[model samples]
Target: MALSPKTKYNIKRILPFGVIWLILGALFLTVEHLALGNQKNALNSAIKLQPDVVLFALTGVTIIGLLVGCIEVLVLRPLFDRKNFATKIISKFFIYFFFFLIVILITYPIAASIEMDISIWDQKVRNRYFDFFLSVTNLSAMIQLGFSLIVSLLYSEISNNVGQNVLLNFFTGKYHKPVVENRIFMFVDMKDSTTIAEQLGTEEYFKFLRSYYGAFSNAIVKNHGEVYQYVGDEIVITWTLKNGLRDNNCIQCFFDMKSDLYKKGHMYLKKFNMQPDFKAALHFGQVTTGEIGVLKKDIFFTGDVLNTTARILGLCSTYKEDILLSKALAHKIMLDNNYSFKALGEHRLKGKAAIVEIVSLLKNP
Candidate 1:
């Protein structure tokens, strides 16, 4: 069975944890070998760093990493997602520290047994395990593991806060210098937002918007779209030209989001005494992307396409359509049988000389 979008996203989020642990495990092994080389032969027998020991350590560390990831995803996230970074780090460290102790207690015996060619239940294995655990080598390894866990937790918190893609780009310097690239933009604006807010009042309207915006996440993730910005009641989603065209993801995202909100319409009515809806416009053009700001850096996209997309979104109410795409962008997309398109004819947009043709798209029943 295919995984849900959220599941896929969670997997992506959890993978880094496993990778981080694997690297740390290898590093620990290398450090152990170097440290053992410096120590007397008498200490080497207490904690053997054999081939089997190496494989077992790496495997155990990876499994522990995945378990830590699951704990964070399933338990820690929902409980402390809204908390401050310090609080999250503190909580995660303590929880993972407990697991770390459990791992050492359990894996040491098995590792020792494998090295000594005896069953873990044997008293010799237990004696060796305790000796190793109390040694300075184990103490050093434990300290390193503790530090690695903290680093991993910090990475997770920052990656989540800045978005995985954005964080990667920052690390890779993909947008440090301005570069122009063809990209697709979708401007989704909440319909009748002003009226809804007035009816729901300020506090309730805020809650309504929260639920409404949250509904877009799954669809956007499934379609490989990145949320560029949220402007009041409107949101800007963007994709690379290739990504937008693949499987007609850009168009499919709109329908999926619409379906999701429709599914949640009853909840909105129950909680806020109203249903919220959105209209979107799609356009594609060249845009310059770059990082800006010294105090707080961020990736920024600047282009006429964004403004044109916004203007096209404004035409949605006039054309009586929920989704409108520029004729240029519509022609580029290899639309599937699931959708039907209607030409909305040429129109002059404000602050532009070009008369651009527009098309309205609908999902066929």
Candidate 2:
């Protein structure tokens, strides 16, 4: 399977670090060869580097660098992406340091085998296995550290770019503009919002509303429902029977929303001593939908269906019902499963010319 968008983005972001590592590895080989006077024989009076020996050493450096690059690109970047900037940076630092420590561990043995003395300058002329390994590992680590710093900086830049693009698109673009068709629209409003606001005060009440709205919105998204608008205490959601409304999924979504609200409401009650209740009205029928407006555009539905949904919501107050659905919606839902609903008979809705059948959703028990 292909990687998720998040994973792909992280891989792209860390690709530069891999390139840097490869470059540094190549440079270390160059510097080492030049410093040793390009000698072919280690036993010669002059430092003689064998072509085969040099090739093998360079190959080892290349492989080590490649491994480091793969780790940085695949493992480190993905882990870092999930965290905040400061945490990500700290994590990258520690991971890179750990890798450097590994390089040191491998280098120490190689340096000892080479018999390279740390105390004197000419004593380092002995081309021992330990010395060769230490030199390459140390240089590779230095190069890796430099690349890590660059990657850390680049990661920040790329993250900012992604964040800005997402915000720009969300605020500006027409999001999932629905096709014009008859469908069910539900508007759920918090009961006694003004009184709750007054009791909780401005800041506390606003926070409560935010949490409540956030939970509901997330539920709507989970149910594959589109939230067209959020007006104060009310959230207007739209779902098509043909496409948007999946009986099992949509019903499950509402249950999930209630569960989320129940948990959150109890938390708020304990913390701020505030009680929040919800009332919803659902109606199904023909409606026109698309992106509307020029300066500040929004995707909206307009028709008798929307009007009827609002009226049904208003009836919640009179009927003492938590949720009220139109006959059309109730009929459709009944086709899927046995959900108890009490019919309220045909009644004239405000602003509606004809009478509409309404039903009260009953507890499953």
Using TM-score as the measure, the top candidate is 1
- Stretches of model 2 off by over 4 angstroms after superposition: 1-179, 335-338
Candidate 1, residues 145-258: lDDT per residue as tens digits? 897788788887888778888887998899989989999999999999999988889998888888999898889999989989888999999999999999898999999999
State, as a TM-score between 0 and 1, how close model 1 is to the true structure: 0.89
lDDT against the true structure, each candidate? 0.87, 0.64
User: Clashing pairs in model 1?
Assistant: none
lDDT of 2 at 114: 36
What is the C-alpha lDDT profile of model 2 across 186-262, one tens digit per residue? 78899899888888889888788777877774576566575666788888876677644554444555666787888
Reference-based lDDT, residue 365, model 2:
48
How far residue 64's Cα lies from its native spot in candidate 1, in Å, is: 2.2
